[model samples]
Target: MPASALEGIDESTWVDVIQKMDEVYSQLIDDEIELEKKNAELEQSQQFIFSVLSAMSDVLLVCNERGVIEETNAALCELVGRTDAELHGTSLYELLADPLSVERARTVLGNTNPARRGEGLELNLFDAQRQSVPVDANCTPRVAASGRRVGTVFVARPTAEIKRAYHELRSAHEALKRAQQQLLHSEKMASLGRLVAGVAHELNNPISFVLGNVHALSRYSNRLRAYLAAVHAGEPAEQLQALRGKLRIDHILDDLPSLIEGTLEGAQRTADIVNSLKRFSAMDPEDRIPVDLNEVIKRAIHWIGKGAVPDFEMRWQPGPPLMVMGSAGQLQQVLMNLLQNAQDATAAHGKADKLVSIETEVVENCVRLHLRDNGPGIAPEHLSHVFDPFFTTKPVGKGTGLGLSISYGIVEHHGGVLSVCNQIDAGAEFLLELPLAH
Candidate 1:
């Protein structure tokens, strides 16, 4: 009620108005106390936030819309090596490393609209000694309880230690990679030594048998000539004939041809095996030349066929002799290993139309050789370890497990790649890639 309305009111009504005023006054005092309590809580909260900001390792800054520094934490003061009074009124740009970083900071801070947050710019701050200190800054607009934009709040942390750690981590990773490769190379050499020893042992048996047969044949030939001389000399034909009959000369003559042929074949086989071993073992690790990969593949197939014709139907699809820069012997070994594997896989399946296919092509200035077989594919669990040293699916004594591993190393030494995978429909496939020679 207005004071003008009170002038016309009766005394009793005025007294009632006075009582109501007293009640209103008491309520107002209670409201004032509650407001005071809330103000005190707000002040405590502000102090706590300021203390936390001061304690942080990262620099925190409060800037107004005009991009002037309003307040900063102890971190900022320590980084600048200045007192609070010296930094309080300075522009944020003045502390940045360069004009570009200054411009970026200004642009980010100028956007005071709460909807548009800063882009988290990275800047380097210059210390009192002019040393660079890298920092990443994330800025956002600060707003009051009345929903008005007050200023911008910046949070930044130094990234020098983080970057140093990253570089060290990268170096350690490279060292570990080199160590693993060295271990693999050592294992490959050991396996090759065993292979050589096994081959030598195998060759000794047939060679010894051949030598014995040759000595026996020489003695038998001498005996036959001497007996013929006795018949020609007037020594009694009947006696000589009787001796010949006793010696079974007729049977000897009949079987000699086969014996000679068998001996020749054994010798030839030993030679072939030796030749293949020579090709495999005569590799010069440092020698690289422009080689015809198609020729290498053909030679590998021929050598593999000479040992024993594979049970599988072998198909060779040779393209115009693709040239690549690599070690011929090592590449040939790689081809032989793959082809041998394909042959064994297809033979084991014992399926009709068992085919081992070798195909070559020139694609994208690289030669690609693909060997595939129609047989049981590699087991899924074993696929990942197929190229690992001493990993094999063959029964013990049937395989040494170093074939593929050595082949892989050989290919890598030649700056090529060897990879294997299960075919889409059936069997497994091996792919070899060699960069084209310039």
Candidate 2:
């Protein structure tokens, strides 16, 4: 019955069905061709990546999520001094001679993601000789298309060159530090020597004056005692009193009172002078503290003005208290050096108008200090080297050239800047700008 029913239908309808089927099959074949193309491209890309890794100058390794070495390039194998057969199944630490190295590597790899770069750790890798060779290594996390967290890929280069460079830099730095310490010691000794000379010169006058005054007082006491003894000798008491009155002893005794008082006053003055000298020289080269610039200026100038170069007029433009984080003794040295310089420059020039003025104010966030002197100004050539070690303009016996250099180091350590410039008309002005603590 089925065969008989088929006899009524036209065969061309079946042709159309066959053609549709053929078209569908054609499309399927096309899809298959396209897939093969994609497959080829993927194979080529993998090959390219593998080649690049093999050619890399640094050791490269890829690990699975379990920290198992899934793939390693030639450089990595050679670095561990092992073949790929030995390294592929091994953990990163097992290949590294020390467990700590692998632990650090794991840490580094943990931090690696697409968002971060320029992060790495440098450590030592043991070579075949069991000697540690430095290596700079970094690892980052790599994710897979299966939506799972993959293990880290480590890329490291032998750090022998960098290690050598570091050793050289360290050596140089140590040498520089020693040189600086020696220079500082020499400078301290020099300063002490100058201080000794000044103190000796200063103390000699007071000592001499006191000694002479004591001698005079001693002689006067002896004479008076003898006179009293003579008066007390065996004559009638009333007669002796009458003789003393007749001589008008009260008038003569007035002169003696004056002499005694004068001698005591002179001795007190000498003592005060000696005390002041002690205070002035009490400066310590290493003591650091918060200090007022105004007080430092006043102390230095007052101490210097006591006996030597007393004719200079010092003027202070009082301003707000200038506070600084610095060494008190160092700043004192800087100011004292400046004032002494001013005095020397002005000694020959000023009769009464010899002047040194200290002015201070704020410039933005920095404190600006100016010490201006009306004296022989510095030449332009000497201005640049004022803070340089062993650079001094004074005659050979006078200046040791370390005062300004040490001052420069102190200011630099405090993050301040010091500079000197000659005034437009005459004299020199030093500018010190110190940034306030933030």
Candidate 3:
């Protein structure tokens, strides 16, 4: 073969080599373009996920199998008083105030032995100050791409307001207790005053009669003495005997017994006034078993204190063991009325004398309790109608006027009575009568 012909014969090899190089270059370019597109898509997806997490206001946290924080949103920063960078990698145990909180959340997430127990759990968290804060927490076990449990995702919200609601309820309860106390005190005072005043007035008559008899006895005794003196002076027998007869000395002497009885009766009448007062106001209601009047009274005051009434000035007079038979509840109602009245009366008027006085004493199987207020005295005209139903000195809508009336009814039901009085000084008073325990 000629050399020129051979050279020309290499055309096939050159074409093949050129064709191979072009094909390889084309493939490389295509692969590079596909790789660039994939990288861009991945970056966009990452940006979208980050944006979603950062926009959320609620705290979201992710932890690894070891309970170490792997990811935290912007919200975690505000929740823990730290930045997301600071929160990441932090152990869940370190982030939580109580390790049990996390345990409880695990249970709620159905990670416990029985699994699938419930949805979520409410937890009370203690702040640095150890104050309770209500929080609702939920979690779910996280799975890796391989379908193995990796960690958990937790979301939480502060429940401080819920705890505040509970506290408010407790406060309301205390207020109720104070109100109950005041009502009982008022009732007792009102009932006692009425009965005592009536009985005292009635006893005056007997006392007067007894006093009259005593005066007569003394006069007769004087005459008998005079007659005897004449005899001792050695007067003529007829004259001495005449004097004795005219003086009625024998009759006078014989009448001494009657005279003494009259005096005793009069003194007894006076005593009856006080005794009746004691009986009327004594703390011995027929409806009740024995109870400590003092303790009951205290409860009444506490109940009333919760209202607009300011701190009351309470004066308790210690007396002999003041146990009485009365319905504690009803009696408490009465006392509540009286105490509220006193506080209200004083409240508008600036709590004059600034004192609420309580006294107890025992007399004749009854206990006498005096509930006195150093408030402005009741007007003379109003005193008579104070106990009347629907009669109130307070402005309209301020009171029902039934406070005293209902108290009166309660006392009556217990076989006792209630009343009020104007003190000689500037104040009003109420007395209660109840039966003494045998």
Candidate 4:
């Protein structure tokens, strides 16, 4: 009967039906292959996402609109001491440590405005031990493909870690400041050390003068004592007169005043030198006061000249006091550094007439001091870097290169300006300008 029924159907029709069936089967096979490829790609994408979530250090949680936990990363699971399966259906509010946090979370999750979504909202969450842990959290609305807000994604970082980072940064800043101060002090000491020879020579002159005056006074004292003893002995008037004449009492009397004056002058000079040295070597004070620039320059020159070569000369005219506002000690240091650098520059060139000439002028509201040296001027290329730390043309051991840099800083701190330029005539000239003290 099946064969009779097949005979009733045309062979061409059967052929057509077979062809249609084959086409349908082939289409099914192609569709199955396509589906398998898509599944492989989906698995790869899921694995990539999982790897990323596991690698993140911050807590991540995804919840539905009802606040039911739909997904969580490894960090959240480890923090709460729960597996993904155990936490899947749990309410987000149940993980909060306090009612306040729960209420805040509710407000944040309920917000519909994307721009007003939770940003840096601090919340306390229950940890593995049920202890509250503070975190800075950001919550963003997670929209589905249909453009509907389906849930909220929470990303948070522990506050303790942020606070620790801030503490470390502040500590580093303080340490850096201390190190800078130490470096400044060390450089000052080095500069002082370099002037030892000059300082000793400066003290020598006053000390030697004092010693000589003391010796003369000692001799005069002896003569006066002998003359007084003769008078007290009740010797005959003529004999006393003879002793007085022999002792040259009138001459001694004439010289005594001069000798005493000389001694006091020498002692005072010595005291001044010692005081200057003490001020120079001591740390600069923070207080600013009116300082006589002319006096400071004179002292710097006097000290630096004492140990310089005999031919080295500084030409400066005593003028009415140029008063400025600054730390006297710091100003002295700047002057000394300038003078020393000039002397070195001249000496290095072996100029026969090594001279440094300083001139001062009163500009509006400021006093400008120009120091010029008769030696090789600064090179065009090196002019800009003269005040840079550790930049020097001198031999490695000959200079520390911090003198000008420190001086520049000191001048700026004093509300002044220090600059240099190659003089057109012969050498480099440094100009220092300071505001006049009211």
Per-model TM-score versus the true fold: 0.47, 0.38, 0.37, 0.63
Residues 57-81, candidate 4: write the lDDT tens digits.
9999999988999989999999989
* Alpha-carbon lDDT of model 1: 0.80
lDDT for 261 in candidate 4 is 87
Q: Candidate 3 lDDT, tens digit per residue, 1-438?
A: 788766755788979988999999999999999999999999999999889988887667788767788888876666666777776887766655676775765454445322222245565554445555556766666776897776777776676665788899999999999899888888887766765554454455555676676667667767877877887888899998898889887787687777777667657655744542333344443445777888778878778877655556888855556676677876787899898898877666684457888888777977788888878878999988877655688874366465786788777766667988888877888988877766
Segments in model 2 whose C-alpha atoms lie over 4 Å from true places: 1-312, 317-336, 347-354, 360-369, 388-390, 395-419, 424-426, 431-438
TM-score (C-alpha) between model 1 and the true structure: 0.47
Model 1 Cα shift for residue 301 (angstroms): 19
| lDDT at position 285, candidate 4 | 46
Local distance difference test, per candidate?
A: 0.80, 0.72, 0.72, 0.85
lDDT of 1 by residue, 1-438 (tens): 788966867899878989999999999999999999999999999999889978999888888777678999899888878877888877777788887788887776665444545558788898767787988888888887998887788889888878899999999999999999999999988888876676676567667777877887787787688788887787887898887887667767886887787688668767865654454443564687889988898899888988896677788877777998877777787888888888888878889889988888878978888898999989999999888655678974355456787787777766778899999998999999888988
- By lDDT, the best candidate is 4
Off by over 4 Å in 1: 1-29, 51-58, 82-86, 106-115, 128-130, 139-151, 207-266, 275-438
- The positional error of residue 149 in candidate 3, measured at the CA in angstroms, is 9.8
lDDT of 2 by residue, 1-438 (tens): 598877867889889989999999999999999999999999999999989988998988788766788888888777768777787877766666566776776666565453334347665676666667667777666677895557777778888877788999999999999999999999999988875675565446546665775776676566566557758787778876776675545545766666666667656655754544444433353554677777777777777776485677788866667777666666776778777778878875664688888888887878888989888788878888777545677764355555666566657766788788889979889887777534
Q: Point out the worst 10-residue segment of candidate 1 by lDDT.
A: 276-285
How many clashes does the backbone of model 1 have? 0
